[model samples]
Target: MTITSVIDPAIIQAYRETHFCVEGDAPLTLRIGEKNETLSALHKASGATSSAFVTAWNPYSRRCDDETNADLQKKLIDELTTRSLCFVNGVGRHPASDWAEPSLLVLRISLEAAKELGNRYEQNAIVWCGADAVPELVLLR
Candidate 1:
């Protein structure tokens, strides 16, 4: 059975338009369903067959203050740190929107774990990729 997302179409569109960027060392940008050579190389170099792009901002697109978002994101980092997961700091930004959020490229994370993290943070969706390095949107709403 297929589950329909309750998330708004506009929000979903914004997600599609936004750039999922991984920062540090070699910066990389991920576009939904697009194969990224740099990302594939990163996966091969790190021996990580999968990666999840997640953020803890604007739960369900309800726009929270910067401070609240920052604190929530810090908590997310703490959770990843506790798990000893390898993650890199990143940000998601849309070309037409000024709003941007702190994000992370979590290496070697399972799809289930990524879904759990997205739900735990009350996000509408996340970007996940496998060894193919093609990002796919996972809606949680």
Candidate 2:
């Protein structure tokens, strides 16, 4: 079944077009609804069945200054640390847009927990992937 949301089509399209890049030693890029062999290998290596690419910037899609966005992102990273979750720093970047939001590729997060985090961060949606490694757009609102 297709998950539906109240978010605008244009915004959803923008989300789909974004390159969710996971940084560090094994930096990789993910796109919504697409499968990536690199991510699949990472998941296998890490023994992670699922992951979520999330950002705390521009809550509910509203523009925020760099400092504010960074502050919010720090909080998000803190939360993950508190939960002892393994994650790699990342960003959601749209090629056509200069704006890039700080993000994370949280490994082994359950769908429920990912949804909760998305809502908690006031994000319109998040990119989540299961064992198949196909990233899906999970709308929070």
Candidate 1 lDDT over 63-89, as tens digits, reads 899899999999999999999999999
Candidate 1, residue 49: lDDT? 99
Candidate 2 wrongly placed segments (more than 4 Å): 1-4
TM-score of each: 0.96, 0.95
State each model's CA lDDT, in order.
Answer: 0.93, 0.92
Deviation in angstroms for 134 in model 2?
0.5
The sequence of per-residue lDDT tens digits that candidate 2 reaches over residues 3-75 is 6788888999899899999998888999988899999999999999999998899999999998998999999
- TM-score, candidate 2, is 0.95
Candidate 2 — what's its lDDT? 0.92
CA displacement after TM-score superposition, residue 79 of candidate 1 (Å): 0.2
